[model samples]
Target: MQNLFYALTFERTLDRYSQADTTEVDVTAKVDPAGRTAQLLSAFFGLDEGLPRIADWAVCDGAGGKDGMPVIFSHEVGLNTLEPGDFAIKRRSGKLGEVTCLTLAPADDPGELRTVLLAGQFGSESDPPVSVEITGDIISLDQSVTFKGAQVAVTPLEDGPSLVLAEKVPQGQWELGKAATGIPFGGGSGCPEGTAQVLRVTWEGGITKPDGNAADDQERKLYRVTIRQEDGSEETIAPMHLADTGDGDNNHKLCLDRTEPVKSIAFPAGGFTDPRGDLNPPTYIGVSQRLIDKQS
Candidate 1:
């Protein structure tokens, strides 16, 4: 058994003169009982000072079903029609939740403005429940709904080794180093023969405009190295280069083997520079590179 509570208030004008001279009266009531419906009653009689008399009243009920489900039922005692009004509800579901809004309109003239109510399970299964109404004016609802979609496909690219330079190098001098070593070519076991590799290098920093040449401020230089496989096809090696100014000393060098195939590489502006020390010119460098697969 579920208990219900109700409160109500109403206002009425007995006459034009009385209404013009007096303020509307307010009334409220609450009902608690084990029932599907509740009732409210009130009355007013003339006593002393007969200027004008009026009666106002209202009754509201709070209740729920056995399953704890939520429902809304509206009853009109004397009103046969209704105008416009807004309504909304929030509900939760397994791993999902939603809010719904619905609108109700008067059927036809002469026909009683019947109360319209919606009841349903909320969340992911279907559209959320909603309700709405408008009197003689227009009404609208703002809605934003979203749902998850399926995952799409992603193709895999061939795995080619990349080349990363060592972080620290011997002070004053530059040393060439390799991050990813190359595999021997074709034998049905490793890299195919005639498979060539290429490395494209771009110089970024380090003694820019050595003599203040026209390319002094360019801040970028490009170079390429390629290795051919026994099969005649080629696998390009990653490119290398220097970064822009501001990256320490910017004097750096990159080394690649005849077997290593370049995959992907990038030399962001100012990527390399000399290690922190008191050295004047600062021993550091920046460079960029790219490797492409060549068709046989």
Candidate 2:
């Protein structure tokens, strides 16, 4: 009985995705009406043309104390239509806070506009922020897709850099398409040879590992990744290289060595240093290969 519904759902989904209806998926969940998986898949099948999504929310800290939250988007945002009031947040205590200020972090570089530091009267240590929501009309610079009323979880202020995303592609391009059907980078060449997976290590605030005097000159290595071989042996490795999308967004694209199946990734203290000369604290991430956002 369950298979029947899904069988029908899959057929409609493929048909819907192939045609002009780019709004939402038209799948029937009446067979498993109470099934949360069916409901969720229905929502995902019908996306808003893969508009700018809430990528990350990190609490921004400084000498002024923990008074800011940095919001990262999936795509480049149009700054001409941006405002602090376009966003809101929900504190851990369930208190809603309004964003009173917004600015591009590391304002020196106008090229990188993905990280916007949102300022407001967020809760104190007793009730720090937990989530952020979009409230106003904001468009992506890449495709002019307006993403509103969407929310995502946030990282705390005291935390250091961590591995947040796993993708098949290194850049901001989506797995199958680019930026949810907008535009893809590169000349249509696919992933590099002998590559298995791509891990995106990101920090809450902004960071840089400068090779030379230039801001884009990057120092990529920052992780000690352990892989479990088919023979049950574990081999640890270093980040071979970093992803260069021509901007700083606290992302370290560590390309994996073949499909050996990763067991864990260990980030050492001082492995990464932010623009402010602060070291990234040590953190170990347990990766479940079964589930990952495979967007290359």
Q: Pick the candidate with the highest lDDT.
A: 2
Q: Candidate 2, overall lDDT?
A: 0.45
The reply for model 2, stretches above 4 Å from the true place, is: 1-68, 72-86, 90-96, 100-158, 170-197, 209-221, 274-278, 287-296
> Against the unseen true structure, what C-alpha lDDT does each candidate score?
0.20, 0.45
Worst 10 residues of 2 by lDDT: 38-47
Name the runs in model 1 displaced over 4 angstroms: 1-27, 30-74, 77-88, 94-103, 108-111, 117-123, 126-296
1-296 per-residue lDDT for model 2 (tens digits):
53345334421110000111132323222222122121000000001111112212211221122254556664445665566666667788899864444555332122234555555466556776777766655555443355566567766555544444332343443122211111111111122445456665444554544331212213444467788888999999875544433333444446665567777777667555543444567767666232233322
Residue 64 of model 1 has an lDDT of 16
Which one wins on TM-score?
A: 2
Alpha-carbon deviation at 80 in model 2, angstroms: 13
